[model samples]
Target: MSEHRPVETWLTDMDGVLVHEEQAIPGAADFVQALQASGKRFLVLTNNSIFTPRDLRARLLASGIDVPEDALWTSALATAQFLADQRGGGSAYVVGEAGLLTAMHDIGFVMTERDPDYVVLGETRTYSFESITRAIRLIEKGARFIATNPDPSGPSPFGTLPATGSVAALISTATGRQPYYVGKPNPLMMRSALNRLDAHSETTIMVGDRMDTDIISGLEAGLRTVLVLTGSTRREQVETFPYRPSRIVDSVADLIRFVDHGKPATH
Candidate 1:
């Protein structure tokens, strides 16, 4: 591979790269601190739309990862931004938590079950059957369907639980209308993050644990991608994918020196 420009900005996945199950991964805090000390333009990305950035910040802080509230990018924010840009200040029937609701409200979207313009779906632990039925009925009556991400399941101590994608599937089956996803693996989210940072893709690096979502999204967005083994994808699974990340490392700790010196980390 040819040499590229020195990375001036950074984008990283939140769950596997920084923390797992509410615990900070090893060297994750130092990695974030390095980015802050270097004044690098950075954003922590997550497909989970269950909580607002402020809410996530508090969670991360409790886990010993001190990330700024504004620096955290979530699918909920992306969905709201997309809606705001597409049709400003529209009403919607949202099936999500505070993160999605707050984002929609901030953009001046009126949440109502009466002839809404869109039916927005996002991550939530509690998915009421009555609300879903209303969303299905509303979509059948001419409302657009929008989902945060395409993740079918989410992790829990008990086991895997149905996520937004699974719920979206049910809605699709009922209404026969597919939703436009606004999160990872859909380059729209990456493009929106770049726009938010005023950063160009060529000078930015996307660090993520999952190849299917993070790597593909970054590649499609024209940014360098690094896959770390600390998350979902193991080292052996890389070859199965038709595409490849620019670099692969064991964990975020390996990239700390690279962040400080502008040199690539040892593979």
Candidate 2:
């Protein structure tokens, strides 16, 4: 593809772009393997902040995808880093899981159920009104709101699940303070990912499924955006969206080949 144009690096989403639910998408692992082999670098940049990089790595390996723990960039990690830098270590009320807690703990952020200075939210397998209500009450008082990511929901093998956005909305309603999202589509998340690459923004590409967040983030960060239909995005939806992706394709496998070897399904 034009003498393997010197792409500085690649930033990609995890769930819809690489795998769906707990299952790996067709050739998704292969695509990662190919890019690594071609001397091209890729970081699994994802909005899913429910898991720590270690947990994410283990899950991927269990599912036959071998990714190093440090290769992933998660919303949870970014949030922790952001809050820690903001002197939020005093207290944090989180409505999430091990991933979210692990990240905060690593960054020295304190987690408490009551009287926290920050209220953090993420995807929960068990979201309850009682728990949400408690968080809301605290937020109404004075807690700052932080959303790991603002995904409305995600497709899983079992079924659809409530995304962290719902919790963010709940907190917003209670405190009248909108949450600061630290995940994808946010320039902050993209900025963190770019820091790892240490590359100029002009030569980087952000690939993902969702348009509002992923593609929009690339636009906001001034990076080339590639949209893959294998995730949450469908071709028809792209036609109606006002923002445009620099390139569109069927899946990550095709995208990997096109970027590295100049080959696609040719359909």
Winning model by TM-score: 1
| Backbone clashes (count) for model 2 | 0
Residues 1-267, candidate 2, lDDT per residue (tens digit)?
A: 233345767888887888777689887888788767877666898777777888899888877777777779988888888888788556898888888888888888777877899888887788889879988888888888889988888766688888898778766876788998998778888888888767667767788888998999988998778888987789889888888888787888777666564333332
Candidate 1, residues 79-158: lDDT per residue as tens digits? 99999999998999999999999999999999999999999999899999999999999999999999999999999999
Models 1 onward score TM values of 0.98, 0.89
Candidate lDDT values, in order: 0.94, 0.80
Candidate 2 TM-score over all chains jointly:
0.89
Alpha-carbon runs more than 4 Å astray in model 2: 1-5, 258-267
Off by over 4 Å in 1: none
